[model samples]
Target: MTTFDGLPPLRDVIQTHGLVAKKSLGQNFLLDLNLTSKIARLAGDLTKCDVLEVGPGPGGLTRGLLAEGARKVLAVEKDSRAMGPLSEISDVYPGRLEVINADALDINPLEQLTAPVRIVSNLPYNVGTELLIRWLTPPTWPPYWASLTLMFQREVANRIVAKPGNKTYGRLAILSQWRTTPRLVLELPPEAFSPPPKVHSAVVHFEALEKPRFEADAKVLERIVAAGFNQRRKMLRASLKGVKPEIEDDLRAAGIKPTDRAEQVSLEGWCALAREIAKT
Candidate 1:
């Protein structure tokens, strides 16, 4: 079937280019144009938005973003095999889609793209979580991108938007929820991709907030969250021992009981703990 963007079908593109998914690179190409369009719409209005799409194997989602009215899309792919197919997309879109041959992990979009930007990608599994943390851990508030619409294995998706008391809640939960509002937009079976993965995948949208829930040093907050949840099963008094010497005093100052586990602490409590730890 012809796609809305008038490009060749994805399977044909893959076959023509011998673009088999790479296991070591965590590549799984989503050939379904309908689903890609669905993810594009979840980023809200994109008419004026410049999108940063990582791992666009065969340009399926890259086409979707353009079809959904994105002003421009910078498609970053590590593999050189896609250069031909993505080039076809750029010719059709005419300056709307720019293909960058590089590692998404090493490129910082904040320095590359203009404002009103959104990052949308069906991230390669190997680097997906690490990329999310990088986006979430920007040095300053009101990060460059307006939002992040990403796909990941369902397990990691659950951890991103997980609530404080949920079993999935941990450092990811605190880091994600503290800085942005993340919600699951769509869930797909493992069979959704060209070479289906072993587990299911889901798309999540994280809208950037103007500020975190409270003021705390980004590095300090990250350290505190990591330490608190490092031994989540242990009480705060024990788990946070290595983070700061006065663990009990920090917990008390945060209005939290030393016996509380990491999962039981709220965002507010974590911020307070961060501040307390900074009280040197």
Candidate 2:
């Protein structure tokens, strides 16, 4: 049977291209076009925006994004096996799809796409968090993408949107919330993929903020957060030893109690401390 877009089923696409899930590449092909389209829709109206996709194995999510009215799609695939299938998608969509045969980690996708882009993908598990951090901390304000709709392991998704005092909250939570408003949009059981992963997956939507939620030097903020969470069990005075000898006074000036532990402090509190440190 044909899919909604009249293309052959994804399993056929995978088999035709000899695309097997490569554990080394962190591949788990999603055969369900319906689920892929749902992920596409979560990116909202794609009629006017370019979509950036990472790890489009057998072009499952690529097909969905094109069919759902993406003005253009720039799909980066590392595994050469999936290129044949993605090439087929490029033909189906004509000028609307551009397949880049390169590692997602090696390429700067923002440099290739037009402005007002939205990244939508089922990211490769091994590098998903690293990619998210790159996007969240691009060197300049008003980042290349307008929003991000990406899938990750359930645990990673929780960390991205976690709030203060939540067990999942940590470096990811601080980095994500500092620059964007992230939401948990969809949850999929392990069975959603061809070879079911041991952990469930989730899709997250992150809309970039026009202005950062707080003001601090990005480098300083990272340093402060890393110090605080690296030794989360310790008091600020002890945990921030790497920061400066006067770090305790700095924390106090930021209105964060010196006695508070890392997890107990809010994102704003971290930013406040970062701002103080930057002044030193």
Candidate 3:
């Protein structure tokens, strides 16, 4: 029944510490403990796993992760204002929680935690997509964490789970689905936050595959996907001009139509195209 090991309610913690959400930091405090707990639960059983959290405004989600039985919680917060509030949680959990007063972008939280880790966070809006992409394209396969449970602007959630031929489908869908199975788990209206964002938000879960769904150099695949979607309305033969002229033969060999647009190409199709381009 204790909240965050014994730290006070997030609101009181924030006020007592004079912590205000700074627009420059892309902070929108989630004060609803119930909602934060919901996000922690969405990460499945954390009894034995380490958890990494980013932009933990007032430690709402951080507390939930620890309370849900995470063996350890490494919280990276860029805002100096939240340190005092988070310190309270650290004292409550003692050795169970570690708070880093650093920007999520600068630190590799995964490397700092033990294996069998799950990254669960209500990410800062400005850096959410960039962070997700970094995790998805880690130099090695089976990157540090087992899965990612992240909150994003609802539009971004759509992109992560978008399928080929859907309007929402594009580079993000192509890249994400190529390496992980992403699913939308929950949605929150703007009202969920102390200062509501203009747009709705959603939590998307990504379970990284041992190997990619298809084979191709990650770099090459990224290039091809970016080129294809850069001019999405154009035909593949036209959109992929940067991929060498001989790419058409490979496309045909892979059973992809040269006239197809980027939106019409599946993740598998993109992999096939990248493999073809890699040969040249």
Candidate 4:
């Protein structure tokens, strides 16, 4: 069996290499190169920059990245079984794709990657949210990556781009909206993946902002938001009590009602509240 491209079909490659999808690694191998290509194109002009792909199982998306004229692709795959197939892609692309057999979480792109990079991956389910948070809230502004085109469980995707008042809106919505403009580009059904995960999946594209949407201490905002949403059922007055001695005063100064819930506050409101908390 051959794929749309000249290479052997991904299913054949998987069988040949005995690359069974491992539940522990959160692997649901994407077997369709065409679908992968669509995801690659969603990242915009890949020719201008390098791409960092996580969990490149059998290199389907890896091949898509390289095929779409990405200057280079640094694909990190923890599954040792994929080395052979990924090596085949490396061989064909020759220096265009570098397969690093390591954990994506441990790789700091700032130290290891070049400028004008884009992170594109069908991220392993187990670590997808963790990795996205890292990318969303980098220590430095104007992160190394030019953009992030990632696939996440639809529920997580909704939360990341969810706006105030949306049921899915929560910490992820606030955190993601603060620093990046995220858009849901594509929604893929479960059948799109080989193992067919129980839930649907979607691709989200995030454009990194030159600066945060508003001004506030990063740590203060993080702490304040965590507390505000700590017991979401509780109103701000109760939830934020421990954040300051005069929590109600802080809320009033920020123009937020003490009775309001976290989901009711806008990004500007959160930043304002963070500044008020800092006054204590």
TM-scores of the candidates in the order shown: 0.97, 0.98, 0.96, 0.97
Model 2 RMSD in Å is 0.9
Candidate order by decreasing lDDT: 2, 1, 4, 3
Could you tell me how far off, in angstroms, the CA of residue 166 lies in candidate 3 after the best superposition? 0.7
Off by over 4 Å in 4: 1-4
**Candidate 1 C-alpha lDDT tens digits along 171-202:** 88888888899999899998889799999999
RMSD of 1: 1.1
Candidate 3 — worst ten consecutive residues by lDDT sum? 1-10
Winner by TM-score: 2
Note each model's CA RMSD in angstroms: 1.1, 0.9, 1.5, 1.2
Candidate 4 per-residue lDDT, tens place, 193-268, comes to 8899999999999998999999988889998898877788789999988888788888999999999998899999
Name the TM-score of candidate 1: 0.97
Give the lowest summed-lDDT range of ten residues in model 4: 106-115
Question: What lDDT would each prediction earn against the true structure?
Answer: 0.90, 0.90, 0.88, 0.90
lDDT of 2 by residue, 1-280 (tens): 9678778899888777788898898888888999999999999999999999999989889999999999999999998887788887888888999889999888877667997799999999999999999999888977889999999999999998988888788999999999999999999999999889999999999999998899989999998898888998899899998889988899899999999899889999999999888886
